[model samples]
Target: MPPVQTVATIRRITPVGAYHHLVLDAPGVTGVRPGHFGALAIGGRDASTLLRRAFSIHRADPGTGTLEFVFAEAGRGTRALAAHRPGDTVDLIAPLGTPFPLPDGPVGAVLVAGGYGSAPMFALAEEILGRGGRVAFVLGAATEDRLFGVERAEALAEHVYVVTDDGSAGRRGRVTDVLPEAVTVTGATEVHSCGPMGMLKAVTEIATAAGAASHTAVEEAMACGIGICMSCVLPVTGPDGVTHFLRSCTSGPVFDGTSVRWDDAGTLPDDLEGAAAMTPKASHR
Candidate 1:
């Protein structure tokens, strides 16, 4: 579905350590899929900042016309968002991009997330459970405070495993360290992951090796969430086995793990169709 551009009212804003969990009353917005994101207009139309910050839909309840986003105050735009109060009006273009595909039959699934990337997994877990599939979670962060949605994961998932770099949480290692055990114990048949590209890559490899299909949500920097700017292009493989650069905002923020060219994620590959044009022609003959 095309995005809905409208003014939304801030219903609540709660601080979660380095990040803030925000809920908006978006009347006309609906059909938000599990992996969809929103492009939020920050500082209003008069502000100096021109680009709208994009965030994954942490949760969206179509029945109530409410959408939630979790974000860290990383810069001016986000800091402006952090300053919002209840009843504040903000512009939003939402329910954008492709969504995660549901499995055809009931299957055990392991949901993995890193840092604030955990934003979208709770809803995904709920979808899985609603489909009669069991869901397990493995969340990791640099430290305890950076972890988001721990309590929700524990309550919603069949089982929850956490890992923190500083050893402040469940296990003192990377998600990769515990992924094998999580899959084994839960009898997971599929994996869904989101977070840093490095973490996604690791999960993809592990899941594939374990004979499970993997789907992942990418966190690329998108200047325009509507795909007008070609800023968030990433290399992805097509069904014909051709490598093509596609926009994450439109083609995907979510894709099959094995379809992405992991090694060339942030950079264009040497043999890419238009890669040569990136280099200027020689001035002298």
Candidate 2:
């Protein structure tokens, strides 16, 4: 289904670092999953950049035809989006990418995020909570200011652990330092994550060591939000050990960490909370 501007009204606009959430109306985003995303053509080709900037759906409210995004004011494209007004027309490409897989039975699930990576994890938390599956979240930030949306995540998880390099918040170290103990205490059997390469690696390592299933949501500098452009390819190691770059735009923003090679993290990232949030962790499956 094509995306349309139902109302395109800003619900809340706050400075998350430099970016803001337009939290507007987008129809046909109900099917969007936790790891999925959408592309916005807010200002059109008037600026030096022609194409649209991609943001993970922070949320998609089917009842209201509303969608939310956590975006950073990185460059020209996003700046254009920030300038958009209420009832403005912003084209959206939504329900893109597959959602994180749901673990069968009562599996302990852990979510780890760094910076804005918390976007998708929030949605995953809601899924786990809805299923009566317990979840533990580990969020890392360089400093207190780098963190956004911890309270939002707390609403979904059993416990929320914050680790800041500056020691202003919960733990005074990397998010990994809080993982082993938290997972053990929470009895986590599966892990979901979205963040920097290092944090993703740490989560993968912890899950591997703990014998838990691990999935990751990765970001790439994208030209096209859809899979048409092979630019956001992620290198993967197949069963035969053949290496190939998979398109993140189409193949997935969410993939088994074991399946995809955690190539160096992207220089730029995408907005994800609602997209990460929509990841279809079923209600009564």
Candidate 3:
């Protein structure tokens, strides 16, 4: 279904660790799926902040017409959004981006997350479990306070592994440290991850090494949240063995881990498709 531009009333805003959990009564926003995101207009109508902020859909309840978003106050826009009170309305365009692809048949899967990236995993996990698949979680953060959903993961998944950079949580390392063991223990044949790009690359590598398929939801910066702006483009390898810059906001936020050109992320590869066409011809001597 096509996305809808609507005003969502703030149901509540609760502080969760180093993030804010926002619940909105969004009536017209429907067809939400795990890994889908929403673009929220911030700073009121006439404010100078024209670009909307994009966030992953943490949870969506179709019956109640409610949507949940988890975000950190990383800048002025997010800080202003967190300051909103209950009953306040915010302009929203929701259920955007490609969602995580579920397995065709029940299978063991491992979900990996960093910081509040764990937000969408619970809903994904529920969907997986309902389909007779087994779930395992490997959550990590800089510190214990930065971790998002340990309790919820434990309550849902068959196994849960926690890691923190400062040793303030379960294991004293990145989520990749314990992921191999988690995959082995759960016999997971697939791995799904959401977090920093560096972490996603490592997770993809590990899952590949273990003979498991990897699906990653990238956290690339999206200036427009829609396909209009070319700001959020990234190098992605097409099936034809050529690299093309694809817009993260429209083409994907979730992509097959193996398809992303991780090594050439920030820099445009010299051999990328259309690279020669974009180069300026040598000036006449």
Candidate 4:
């Protein structure tokens, strides 16, 4: 189903370390799945920050008609959003983008997250477990405070590994450092991750090396949240063995890790589809 734009009232905002957990009464929005995101209008209807900020949906409770997402005060838009009080209404277009694909049958899977990227994994883990699958979590961040959802992950996953760069948490290293062990211990056949591009790339490589398929929710800038704006295009190789710039907001947010052109992220590759046409032909000498 297509997404709906609704004026969702702020239920409450809870401070979670360096992030804010926002809950909204959005009855109009439904069928939210893990990896889906919501685009919220910041400030007010006529505020200067015209662009809607995209946030991955943390949890959606259709029974309560409430939706949850987490964010940090990174800039003007997020700062304004952080200032919203309970009962205030914010325009939201939600349940957007492709969601993480669940395994058809019961299977062991490893979930990896970095920083607030842990927001979406709990729900995904729950669904995975509901299907009789086993889940192991490897959560990492720069510090302990930046890590989110440790308690919830522990409650749901069979094993939860926490790591921080400053040694403020379980281990002082990246998630990749503990990922192989997590997969090995859980006997996970699939690896799912959401985090910074570099982290996702590393996780994908590690998962592949461990003989597990990887699914990644890329953290790309989505200026519009919708596909209209070409801002969040990334090079992705399709099944036909052709590289095309796919929109993260539409074609994905979740994609097979092996399909992404991780090495050529920031720039268009010369071999990308239409690249030859876009490049200027050698001038007649």
Candidate 5:
């Protein structure tokens, strides 16, 4: 289905350390899946900010017609968004991009997240639990305050592992440092991850080594949010065993971990299967 532009009323905004969690009342909006994102136009329609800022859907309550998203003050766009008050109306283009695929039957799965990348995992955990499947989580960040959902994960997941880089939280290490052990302890058959590209790559390697199926929601800077601009492209192995540039905003944000060509992600290598055939034509004299 095509995306819809809706005027959503801001319910409230809560500050969690350096991040702002915004909840909006979006009635008539439905079918929002975990890992889907929203492109919100901040600073009002007549304000200086023209482009919409994209954020992963943190949580959505269909019954209440409310949607939640979190963001840190990265730049002008986000700072403008933070200045908004309750009762303010924000334009939203929501439930965009592909969602994390579900397993065929109930199976133990491990979810790994870094920083605010954990935004989408909670809703996903709820879905998995509803289907009689069990879920475990590994949450990591640079500091204790950056870890957003540890307490919630502790309550929901069968097991929760927290890690921080500065030794200010959980184990003083990366998620990869403890991922293998978590997979083994939970007897996980699948691993789903959303974080930095490097972290996702590491998780893919670890999960593969453990003989577990891995899926990941990639983080790519997007301009159009939808796929028209072709700004967010990544190399992915096609079904025909050839590498192709897939749009992250449309073809995915979620893809099979094994199908991604991580090393050649941003570049088209000469040895790539279809690289030669896709060469550009010379300019006319």
Candidate 6:
């Protein structure tokens, strides 16, 4: 949001399990909100991965102009991030997308994250707690090895729940297995979830039935990261009677779960209606 600053270099890189945490010299752009993301341009100029990779702002330092980006080490793009040492300048188009709005109530929030989804929610947890709200984090992974940032999340939230499918960690089941317990024990009256499509769906059902407000963060293979390219279209019901396809980039990584057409995850139908998309041009201005 500040005047165009030079590309901030990576000050440090630390590997945390399956994800890498990068500290960049992003000063004026540090006061970013939760759910808003930035674009990090890495790799050589000739590399096929020229465009910036969209990363959720995990931590920010407005004073120092530094940022912490947490990303999974899944492919060449991320591997490029992992390979960065100190003193490397990475171009970033930051502070993009709308933020998650904090709902008011005698509200207790339960954040359910599958894996790296914890990065954004952990940042959110601190804000919620600081505002006198409460949170219980329910984390899930396939096994103990797949679990990441347990200690930090536990520290951020008042309470924590870990669920692993292979039984290698807290409980031998899906993350949903711990929801009822989390709600009952922590008295978390609202829910926010980000993870695999299945887990999000399950949480949606649970929260819907319990009469709890719920939000979901959707994941996809993004091209522009901004909404210029329509590669990330999703189906949604609009204000009018017709349902439509929307852009995932600018409209959301976060959306009201009930409003999202979950059944259309990987394969959005071509003719879906109410297809308004909030491109970066719209969100930034």
On lDDT, the candidate that comes out on top is 4
Residue-wise lDDT of candidate 2 within 1-285, one digit each (tens)? 433333244555667763476687665566766877877766644756668677887777788877788887778788777777665676666767776886555668888888777777777777777787888888888888777788876776658899999898778999889888878878888888887766777788888898888898876777887778777877665677655567787777787788766643332212222334546677995
List model 4 lDDT by residue over 172-208, tens digit each.
Answer: 9999999999999989899999999999999999999
| Alpha-carbon lDDT, every model | 0.91, 0.74, 0.93, 0.94, 0.89, 0.77
Q: What is the TM-score of each candidate against the true structure?
A: 0.96, 0.85, 0.98, 0.97, 0.94, 0.89
What's the candidate order when arranged by decreasing lDDT?
4, 3, 1, 5, 6, 2
Q: How accurate is candidate 5 locally (lDDT)?
A: 0.89
Q: Give candidate 5's TM-score.
A: 0.94
Q: Which sections of candidate 6 miss by over 4 Å?
A: 1-6, 104-106, 239-241, 268-271, 274-285
Which model is ahead, 1 or 3, in terms of lDDT? 3
Q: Over the stretch 174-285, how does candidate 6's per-residue lDDT look in tens digits?
A: 8788887787776776788877777888898888777777788777667887789988766766667456667777888787787777887656454554223432235664
Query: What is candidate 3's lDDT per residue for 80-133, written digit by digit as tens?
Result: 999999999999999899999987779899999999999899999998898899
Model 6 clashing residue pairs (backbone): 26-65, 27-65, 243-273, 243-274, 244-272, 244-273, 244-274
**Candidate 1 wrongly placed segments (more than 4 Å):** 276-279
Candidate 5 per-residue lDDT over residues 98-202, each given as its tens digit: 999876678888999999999999999988888888989999999999988888899898689999999899999999999998899878889999998989999
**Worst 10-residue lDDT window, candidate 2:** 266-275
- Over 196-253, each residue of candidate 1 has an lDDT whose tens digit, in order, gives 9989999999999999988999999999899899999999988888788999999889
